[model samples]
Target: MSTFFHIHHDGDAHGPEAQRIHTELIEPVMRDLEERGRLDRFYVLNFSGPRPFVRLIVEPRESHGSNLAREVLASLRSRARELDFLGEHDIQPQGKVA
Candidate 1:
């Protein structure tokens, strides 16, 4: 399965806050997953709309599956909260995609 996190922002896509989340939180986790061979594919999608946002998609290897995605999502939630970039309502899951 594939899981995703939608990160909403009020500022521009290239703003410091967005960059920080990408660099400080997302990249490191992605690198670790890649190094461990637990990742299938990942995508960072940016959108500009009434509520500008970024979508982080993580598809783990079948051997790891949704469990790995769940763990990654949890870790990201915690880190985002700690960094004050995300609040409880900031992230919304779009459910599992096969």
Candidate 2:
């Protein structure tokens, strides 16, 4: 099954360490997804505020064997910890059949 995964986190999405994690951990996942033809687009978004908001959107090419939600959860979870994100995160999954 294919999936479109949306991840939400409270952190400094643009900070140096956050950027490192984004490039290293998160980008790799998106790479694998693209290679498998399961990735339409993957990207991180940031919000401006005292309480920062960060998110990654995963758009899959097909809805078969989709584990984007799980994968994204892991990425966000791990990176946030390593980066010591000032805020916690809430991961949300959204899917649509194509």
Candidate 3:
């Protein structure tokens, strides 16, 4: 299974704010997970369609399962909330289900 973070962006705000979040918030955590062999891949993508934003996808290692992935994703979501990237909500769960 995979974990996905759907990030909301404010175009009016400076671009680096989002960039900083990726560099400072997301990357290190992802790298740590990767180092532990928990994460297979993680990426942030920007789309040009309606309501532009970045999506973070975490694919777990072959030895890792969806439960662990969800736990890590949950931690990331909480961190995003703490960082004010998400309000009370805004971090949505998407894609294929169990």
> Which order, best to worst by TM-score?
1, 3, 2
Cα RMSD of all models vs. native, in order, equals 2.4, 4.7, 2.9
lDDT per residue for candidate 1 within 1-98, as digits (tens), equals 77887878776777776787688878887888889999988888777778877789888899998578677877777877777776756666677623
Worst 10 residues of 1 by lDDT: 89-98
For residue 9, what is the lDDT in candidate 3? Answer: 59
- Residue 46 of model 2: what lDDT? 67
What are the models' TM-scores?
0.81, 0.56, 0.71
The ten-residue window of minimal lDDT in model 3 covers 88-97
* Ten contiguous residues minimizing lDDT sum, candidate 2: 1-10
TM-score of 2: 0.56
lDDT scores for all predictions? 0.78, 0.58, 0.66
Writing each residue's lDDT as its tens digit, candidate 3 over 1-98 gives 66776666565223775676577667877888888888888778764445556677788877776565566656667777676665535455566434
Write model 2 residue lDDT over 19-88, tens digit each, in one string: 6546765787678768877668876776556655445666666663456567656655666567565333
- How does residue 45 of candidate 2 score in lDDT? 70
Summed backbone clashes in each candidate are 0, 7, 0
**Mind sharing the TM-score for model 3?**
0.71
Off by over 4 Å in 1: 96-98
> Which one wins on TM-score?
1
